[model samples]
Target: MSDASLNPTATDRWMLPEGIEEVLPPGAWQLESLRRRLLDVYQRWGYQLIVPPLAEFLDSLLTGVGHDLDLKTFKLTDQLSGKMMGIRADMTPQAARIDARQPGNGIRRYCYIGSTLLTRPKGVNGSRAPVQVGCELFGSDALAADAEVVCLMLHSLEACGVPATHLELGHMGVYRALLARTGISEAETVALFEALKRRSIPDVDHLSASLPENERELIRALPRLSGGLDVIGKARALLDHADLTAALDALEQVAQCVQKDFPDVDIHIDLGELRGYTYHTGLTFSAYRSGMGSALAHGGRYDGVGASFGRPRPATGFSLDLRALLPLIQAQATPPLAVLAPAEGGEALEAAIRELRRTRPVIRRMPGDALEDYSDSCDAMLTCKDGVWRPEPFSNRS
Candidate 1:
């Protein structure tokens, strides 16, 4: 009946919006573990990790990313300098900006694991505040370079214990070459690309109606060129234009190379999978799991995008959504160690706990605490008595 009665203080006060979240306790540990595992894989492959700042100037960030992303970035003005700054919605552009600023003599390999914030519709099911783990390779344009990135991604997923994942590959060059033959306007090309992304045959047909008859036929065939290894042969036949055929050939070569190294890996060719930042001038791909509705990792070649920033390097990489993989990893995780401590001897117990932590994660539970009463929750416990460590057997029942 009254405002205060209907809405309490917590409900009435303005707070941070829904999409953003606070990482706490176990979630923080899982986040750090995922980052560590991913970074280890990157380092083994010669990618040095780089941490770009959270805030960057608007112009630098939006250079290669399209208008849609620019609209989503969180904008703010510097308090002292009064310059417009934005919280980065993605990390790849920031890496590009960093590479442009600091020129390397030859090729550069970089990796990062960082948090990214994005605005999503209310009640979105998955995490909007994501932790992105990615690697970027610069100054190589060979199809072999693209295949290397794909292989590294597969290895990283395996290290993280993800099972039965498939890599869906596509060549943006093929689609762009077909578009070039049409002599269509930029607006028509963008419209047709968007239609292909959505896999809407009717929309693609309607959008290509104004183009030449030959162009329309090629555009209509895009949605059909997605499947297993056999799809590559179909694409080579269906795509008659020389440039398109050449691009498809390059993709086939890369696929064959990857299979040679990883004979059991599942690979798919999808000509209609057109999602990438505007900078990706060549190949693009995404990794998907069986039950996961969305891609767990996605990236592509951005040879020209780096050039826009004065670097003039060819690069490609993939970003894995660490947050999405957490649940699956947790389901298979080994239980952590729980150490019981004496209330009066916290200092000595803490010292021993620190030693134990080097080998395994330790959760401290004090004597006379409910955790001590219920030993079943812990793997094992160390009781502190007279400055000595006494290992105790954990009972199955409290």
Candidate 2:
């Protein structure tokens, strides 16, 4: 791609940047309906809603989030102070900053849905501007909190009518423990993490070459440790470290709770699903529709996200692309048909229009406007007959 190639011709001037999109008509309406529906579900779960700023100081935005987000964020300079600023690529950190201001260690539940502008797509042809919806719980380290969040995630997908959803659970702490036992430098740990994420045997072997035999063997098995419930048992038997047990217990407990509640949801365990490996502190899970290659929703515990705000409290959450959900949202109710009003209207017609609008939409025809102007929206017209105004089926005459 060159500068010349970047130049837009007149025919392509309306072309949006790659990976960016705009929802139109009924799709936008459906998207809003899903947003409202899920937010209501979150409210019922006692997760209060909050709207974080779309952009903020760069340091404030990226300080405690991991390198993955650091790469996705779009940066700019604020004119007021010459300070660097960034458009939010993820709302989790901003929510954490808000939580850090709380007075006590009491559990605070918050939910948010907003536009997130990423510098690049998250996956192939993924949206760069996603209407991200998520819920965050702070101040609790118990596995119960993890389970509760997972439950809410299921409720979210169900509310949107997403079907055949399966969940894959992982524990970053397990991977972290193995990495720690290796006693490798920060750089080495990061390199090994990348290799494990890819599950490349050659890379894993090469990276763990100098590590202890036991430590190397444990981590080398982590990527391949994804499957049914038996994966938990397998990891327990294969891993010799006691530290690994706690993380494993956390994963199992959360998995059990999810299974018991969401009986139909197919569950899989993936120790290598190091979603935000350097960022997430503990149990992580992602939900996928049967055939979709990418996760529709995913979240994990990222306890240190608030440390930069001076309050290091436990936190966990998940986010999904609301705009991406428009197609899959099958149950949105049809909005009521709008009623049309004649441009020439007396006090009676005006009052009738107002009264009708109270229950449903009413589109008043402007002077010089024909009935066809609202043909796509309005079905009936308010008519003055005798002394009363009543609605009659509207027919376009010209």
Estimate, for each residue in 1-398, the C-alpha lDDT of model 1 and write its tens digit.
Answer: 99887776875565656666666656667667778888888898999989988888888877877877777688899897888988877899888877777757477889998887765521347666777788888878888789889888877788788843688888888778877788887787788788888999999999999888877888898899889989888877777777887788888888888788778768989887777636578888887788777777788888856666876778888888787787787788854546554455566676877787777656665555675464544666677567676656565435
Writing each residue's lDDT as its tens digit, candidate 2 over 1-398 gives 97657985776888889999998876787788788899889988999999999999998999887688888999999999999999999898889999998788899999999999988998787899999999999999888999999988988988888853699999888888887778899999888878888888899989999988898888788878989989999999998678799988888899889989899999999988876876888999999988788888899998867888898999888888888877666344554577888787788888888898888778778888766777777778888889888888877533
Superposing all C-alpha atoms, what RMSD in Å does each candidate have to the true structure?
Answer: 3.2, 3.1
Runs in model 1 deviating more than 4 A are: 1-8, 11-16, 121-123, 344-358, 361-368, 372-377, 383-388, 396-398
Q: Against the hidden reference, what TM-scores do the models get?
A: 0.89, 0.89
lDDT of 1: 0.77
Q: Report, for every candidate in turn, its global Cα lDDT versus the true structure.
A: 0.77, 0.86
Clashing pairs in 2: none
